[model samples]
Target: MSRWSSSLWIPIVAVAILIGSILTGGRADSDPQGRPVVVYAHPPCPPDLMRYFEEAFADFRQSHPEINLQVLHITGNYEDKIKVMFAGKVAPDVIFMYPTALPAWVELGALRPLNDLLGTNVADYFAAGVRT
Candidate 1:
């Protein structure tokens, strides 16, 4: 795997958890079932990693079955795809993107600030990780 892909694996799972929380309001009994949470990521993984990724999602589903997850792996130009998604009003609830693209997304009003969601636990993230 490339350096970017390796580095993103853990964070992608983290984002999935966050999405689950957001969709279910952190409550399994919140009637979150059937609510769809779309996720857009790049460069489909190799077979082994793909199995692992699917397993992770399966585990999440076991706990939060109400929230439906739709994951899309893009192999072409990610930025262009993202732009098209936003323009078409079909952007994913979670996007696995390189940090470098954040500013442009923010400037275009395509991204929402996550500060409120992160709250005082911001220190839990690495300084470099939060910088993006």
Candidate 2:
């Protein structure tokens, strides 16, 4: 693979496994049928980028048979839609936001500090800035 594609792998892998790890706690199963549903909501991306995410999630689904993975690519007016979701007290298990929106969400207390649960793992997968 080219250097560019290879570089994308680390973050993609992190995001894929993060869907299950962060939300599932240690149970790995929510329903009596024994499969926890994991929903990840991301803003719309270019076709290529979305393809990469879908491929990564496909791999994640195959690897984690115990979890049901649902990817929601929210299209158009992402920020507004997300705000409406929070207003309605509806949110996905995993949410992806750009750097600019991060502060607002933090202020609204929509996100929780994962320091206890993730420890150094976040640092290991994400950039230094994302940790803060």
* TM, every model: 0.57, 0.66
**Candidate 2 global CA lDDT score:** 0.77
lDDT of each: 0.71, 0.77
Model 2 residue 12 lDDT score = 97
TM-score of 1: 0.57
lDDT of 1 by residue, 1-132 (tens): 698898998899999986776665533322355475645454556778788878887888788766766667776777788787677555676787677777888888988767678888888988876775
Q: Which stretches of candidate 2 lie over 4 Å from their true place?
A: 1-32, 119-131
RMSD of each: 15.4, 16.5
Model 1: residues with Cα > 4 Å off, grouped in runs: 1-36, 119-124, 127-132
Which candidate number maximizes lDDT? 2
lDDT value, candidate 1, whole model:
0.71
